[model samples]
Target: MIQVKKETLYAGMLKGLLTTFDLAKIIIPVSIVVTILGKSGALEFLADFAAPLMRVFGLSGKAALALFSGYFINLYAAIGVILTLSLTLKELMIIGVMLMLSHSLFMELAISKKAGCSLFYVLLVRLIPSLLVGILGGWLF
Candidate 1:
């Protein structure tokens, strides 16, 4: 039997990022559409729906205007914009944990399904604990 190594969290994150880059390619067109929708004032209409959830994360509803962008946007644009924002290292760390917790949304699910694991189980594993940590870390830090 082959054993799995689970030493470094960063290692897993990097592995996820590498696989996700294939699909993160979608960020460009999605960003363009979001920008167009925002400029046309249509995004505001939908922002109303996600704002409450965003508030729980300590962000505004408009912040989720970039939900699909995180997977689509290029690293240069994403990192530069976020780095220039008002976030601290703690927030960034939490974002990292949250992202690594949720990266490659499509691929992770498919792989897990093919491996005979339940998607619900995978989601519970990926979403719940990292969110607990992210929320606690954000509050404590």
Candidate 2:
């Protein structure tokens, strides 16, 4: 049993598929928003909203797209953009942690729901800690 598990691609595919199903809620909605209303005008509002907060972390409004894109898409996509754009490894490490700590928001919520927990509270668990860690890591590096 352990040997088969060790040799299996099925295990990885299963995990990925399960994750996709769980995150479909948040992912689907966000994707629609991006597809239908993600023009610069649409995101400009967030510039005002996130400016002071992001400034504290030494990032700009443009970084929010990186965060959101990382959260929404597979990590490879985010990393790909970072590599293609020639960001430093220090920057990529920070980005990688930020993405790793939070992906498939909708899917995880559903998982907790099945387990009889509050998704909002669970959301706070992921959001607050990850941000704190990412900030500290970004600063320390």
Candidate 3:
């Protein structure tokens, strides 16, 4: 029979709670900031600036906000932006796959480097596949 200690369970719960708090710290502030940017039309300006590049992925200029949020901040912020937009199913799927492939670049890249991976190689590996998949998805759907 397997036994679990009460102290061990409590410690695990504490760790989980702390992790959630850390994530919320990042996510909540980012969500609020992005909301402000959207309301103030700054997000639209950014989207317009990125439109040409975004079109290659079959996504609208507005999707640039989600992609930038996902890349710099995290996936939760990206989802917040995505929720506010009216996107087609195909666009959502393409963005979903691309974000899955390359989100959290700075944090993950640092973690990869700490794990002894070459930073440039890790970056290329993460970004190249994301771009390729985005292009393919754009072409197909």
Candidate 4:
């Protein structure tokens, strides 16, 4: 029993380390790129253009980068942006809900299609709820 428990503990530790390493691989590069864009004023330009839409969700224009990364890339990429930004707890909560509902769009859409789900249906299911949450969260908080 002792040997089995020790083996399990070691296995769990290895898995945790591997997971952390994988997340770091994605988050580090994304954070660096976002930081560069922010420094160069490119993010501000994009933010201004996206401000209207992002505002509806009670997020700053820069937060749109996080949403875009979450939707198009993955949660880790969004986290990278979120970590670099100084967002309020409310903003973080709203983004968290939205991303939870609809992250990794392209990859998930393909997987859903392969699994016999319609592209439109999958998109509708994810995006509609996310939009509603964003709108409601924006208004309430």
Best by TM-score: 4
TM-score of each: 0.58, 0.56, 0.83, 0.89
Ranking by TM-score: 4, 3, 1, 2
For residue 12, model 2's alpha carbon misses the true position, in angstroms, by 8.3
* Count of steric clashes across candidates, in order: 2, 2, 0, 0
- Model 2: clashing residue pairs? 22-107, 23-107
What RMSD, rounded to one decimal, does every model reach? Answer: 8.3, 6.0, 2.3, 2.3
What's the lDDT for residue 73 in model 2? 59
The lDDT of each candidate is 0.59, 0.63, 0.86, 0.93
Q: Per-residue lDDT of 107-141 in model 3, one digit per residue for the tens?
A: 89999999999989998998899888999999999
In TM-score terms, candidate 4 sits at: 0.89
lDDT of 1 by residue, 1-141 (tens): 966677666799898898778545554455566567668877677778877775555544554543223323333334433433344565566555566566555667778999998989887887787567657755666
Higher-ranked by lDDT: 2 or 4: 4
Q: Which stretches of candidate 3 lie over 4 Å from their true place?
A: 1-9, 84-86
In candidate 2, position 120 carries an lDDT of: 87
**Candidate 4 local lDDT, 44-112, one digit each (tens):** 899999999999999888889989999999999999999997788988999999999999999999999
Which residue segments of model 2 deviate by more than 4 Å? 1-52, 74-77
Clashing pairs in 4: none
